[model samples]
Target chain A: MDEMTIIFSAFLNGMGIVFTVPVFSAMMIGIVAGMIVGLIPGLGGLVAHILLIPFALQLGDPLAAIAMLLGVYAVTSQTDSIPAVMLGVPGTAAALATSLDGYPMAKRGEAGRALSASYFASIFGTLVATVIFILFLPLLRALVTKFSSPEFFMMVVLGLVMAASLSGRSQARGLLMAGLGLILSTVGQAPGTGDPRFIGPFLYLWEGVPIIPVLLGLFGVPEIIDLAARNRSIATSAPVKKVSGLWLGMVDCVKDWWLILRCSVIGVVTGFIPGLGGTVAEWMCYANAVASDKDKDSFGKGNVRGIIAPETGTAAHLPGAVIPTVAFGVPGNPPMAVLLGVFVILGVRPGQEMLTYKLDETFMMVNVITVGNIIAAALCLVFQKYLVKLCYVRASLMVPFILAAMVIGAGFSRLSLGDIAFFAGAGIAGYVFKHLDWPRVPLVMGLILGGIAEPYFFASIDRYGISWLYARPIVLVLEVMIIFMLFSTPIKAFAARLWKSGVRSEGSKHGDNT
Target chain B: MAITPENNLQPVDRNQSIAFGRRVDWIVSMIILIIGIAFIIMLQSLPGRATIFPWFITISIVFITATYVYGKYRNKAVWDELYDPDTKDGDEMADTGPAFVLAHRRGVLISLGSFLLVVAMTMVLGPEYAVPLFVFGSLLARKENWILAVLSGIGLWVIIHFVFGDMMRINVPVGFLFGGFN
Candidate 1:
């Protein structure tokens, strides 16, 4: 078939799948669940994704399952702002920037305006990201055809390096966790030889450590522990009496179309990088907003642009993050790492297959993001006042319920008692890691990619011997990219210093001239 | 950084917390180094091809961890910056009052203990009994009202029984005492 015809057909097929009863219904459920989770401080889409994985697996339809998860992923940036605006407690890490200006607005009784502006900005951001994603698909399709085992191996390495370097201030620590993850992935039987490496008398280890339990333990338990320790409601303030200026907020977003577009683009670019995720995107956009504005001092004091920039950027980031995940199986962020795991479980291979045979499914995911965001924004607009109450639900009330869900979710992974034990162990480790400022994302990326990396490593070696390192053009290119990514931070820092010095010199010279 | 209400830690407490965190980091790095060494030792038993990747990873772990430890030791500024609250972004520095710290430590223990207890309970009494009991016990322990705890427990039971048991048809364990239901 012609490219255009294939694209059109895939688009239709994607819409058809999305509109199906099971998929559409599940998406709605996911959207609502995401909103609830997003409103609750400390519990974000990652937790929701981990908790729902077992259920999504049970649903038995990949499209429905993924659509449901994507629904959760897409709308979080919208509802997470609710808590950020109302209570100054960001519901998710990405909402931290939103809370900066959002809380000030709420304190000024423009909570409705800030929220509605965020909602609309998020909607526009997702729409812009979707367009960018669509435009990139053709180019990605062309690029993915050149990938092979050696290239794939290097791609995974590049992803790990990028994640490790960018995830935390300490690249060495991040790499250590990643190395540990790779080692852990070796627990199962060796790929070709079928000999167990670290089974240690446990029969279940033959399949390797289950992803679900580990994910829950690593991400979910730590947050729950922290919340329980804090031992209070998420919101200390009374819920807003009535939300007003929502229309004004929407109008403001419309008037600030250029800002929304610019920030959305920033978000997409940031999102395309492996470890630079929604938090970075939002903050960068917020900084940009502050820098470009004439009355920068007015920011952090109820500036609407502050709300618009971050929200748009963060909303745009989700789809941008999905691109590398869909095209290369390299997750753009931690949550995408979990989503990529689900995609694997659903019998979907990312990379070339996603671009070729499974293009329709990719389009389906895009559609879910688009439709999910629209529904989420509408729901938030209508239920703004009611949703604010979720922020006030006591952590004491939430902990047990979330704990129950975690236990059940972990157990369902393998129907094994061993999984729960693993979960508990991982949770403890995760809590420590969180407190110690260790980056967890690289570890997750390493764990998920480890299984895939090993086989590709062996395959490349077997097929081309060590010459595969230099034999393939793409592999060589990837090697350079990996090295560059490892040192990008220092390079950027050096350049920034140079730029600052140059600017300072120019200013001094100008003063002398005056 | 976002001006959340949670950023209320006193400067002294925050500095102390950072010190404590640095100590923990040192301890964790040492533990990782030891583990990596042990793994390298363990990799000796595997066949050549099977051991290749593990050996690479194990050695990488050892090398990377050693480098991290050495770098931190050699560089005081970097070491300080590693746990410096001012250098960090995203999550606020955790409150580190003595009482809150103790409570936090207790909370971590309870969280882990409760999970393990649930697992043990699941093995002995089955999820049907274990889940509700856990919800009830946890809620009450957390000082929630008894009526609400009971209702929450009951509500959880209905969901587990209906959603997971009947609808999904997961073969939930029926308890060792009651004759395990697989």
Candidate 2:
């Protein structure tokens, strides 16, 4: 067949698979299930993906199974904003940025507007990202091949630096926490030699720290503790008299189309890079929004743009994250990593063949992202009135329930008592960090990226020796980016001072002329 | 004394809070420096490749902590900038009133103590018993109505039993006294 004919045929076949009764129905079920799971704080798409793996295997049909899993994966970002906006609690790490402005808006009785804006922004982001995915599918092979161990290591370093610099008020504190996280990540056996480094006596440390329990402790527990301490409902203002701003929220998204587009691009780019997922994407977009706007103070103070930026970025990130997994078997994020495993179990080889003969399967994923997000957003919009009421529940009543749910979620990570102990420790530390102004996100980014980084660093040195640092073109480019990222704040501050002095001198000269 | 939305309580003397914050920072930084130094010492025994990353990170931690401490001491303005109360995004600092401060401390202690107590209770009594007890006790301690607290506890137990126990089929720990769920 000619290339055009093959493309047309693959597209039709993909649509056929999606429209099939079993696949479509399975996807719908997964979408609903994912929305429910996303509403629960700390239980993210990663856990849901793990739980559904066995069921996906039992289903016995590749297309149906893929549809189901992808359905779950794509929609979690849509509904995770619920708890983030209604309460100060993020349903997932990706929703953290949403809570910055979202909860404040809720406090001001605009919960309906915030929730609606989030859902619409997410839907638009997914649609835009799906289009980008399709348009760039042909170039994925070329793009992924350009990266090697040296480049990958640089990317990881860049991610860590960016996260550390952007988070919290003090860049130094963020870097310190990130460094601590990196050291903690080295607790397990070394990647190259398999020799235990810092396990000490506890066998649990040999596997290093599990991310989920630590995440629950770091983010979830501190919020719960604070809520309990405050002794009030999440929103301190009078009860919302009306939940009628859903349409207005959608209107806000439309009004901010340019911002959404820029954020979506940021999302897609970050999501395309391995190890830099929704968390990083959302933060970068939030930072970008703050940087570009004249009214920077409005952010974290109930700015609608803040909610729109992160929501759009994370939503676009879903499809961008899937591209590498489909093309080169390199998963973009943790959930996509799980999806890659599902692909292997279903006897799908991800490579050139996925682009050629198995193209239909890839397109099926695109369909899932498109259709799944629409369904999820529609459902959330319809039921958001009831969802917003969760903000009004007394903290005394909500705290224990949330704590129990968090414990149960952490327990599910390993089904071990050690994890619970670790969770408590992390919670205490998290509370302390929260009390102080240290950023917790960089620490998390460090822990996650450290394990991936070490192996790549070793591989680069082993294969290319020390010259890999300066020899590789991509590595050099990335090194420059990292340097710029590290020094950008100081550089910007100095430039601003210089500009003010120049302006002052110019005004003095004009006065002399006068 | 007037209340503010951000502070949520009558304003306290700013200088006093900054002093307290600086003391807290000193303690925290010193602890981190000590831990980093200890880790660096420990990494000395590991093999070359194994120690490389940890050594770099621990040294960085120590360096950063030292720089932070030194910077704060040399310039009080840096401390002021870093410890600005108004810059806080989420939860604000507790009021500095003596009674409110005591209540805040109590709240922190209670929160931490409850978490540890529940974990300890679970180890002995299993999640089935521990979860309901924690919920009921915390709600009642918060002075919630007795009937509502009891119902809330029961409602949580039912969810745990049905959803987690039955639907998910998680092998929930049965506590040391019970030996096992079996």
Taking all chains together, the TM-score of candidate 2 against the true structure is 0.74
The runs of at least 3 residues in candidate 2 whose Cα sits more than 4 Å from the true structure, single-residue gaps closed, are A1-121, A235-263, A266-370, A493-514, B1-4, B7-13, B89-106, B143-169, B174-182
Q: Each predicted complex: what DockQ?
A: 0.41, 0.35
TM per prediction: 0.91, 0.74
Per-residue lDDT of candidate 2, residues B22-115 (tens digit): 7777887888788899888888788887877777688788988998888778778756755555444432322122222223666767777888
Q: Give the Cα RMSD of candidate 1.
A: 4.4
Model 1: per-residue lDDT, tens digit, A31-76? 9988887667667777887788888888888888888888999888
Model 2's CAPRI class is acceptable
Record all residue pairs in model 1 with backbone atoms less than 3 Å apart, i.e. clashing: none
Residue A371 displacement (Å), model 2: 3.7
Cα error, candidate 1, residue A251 (Å): 2.7
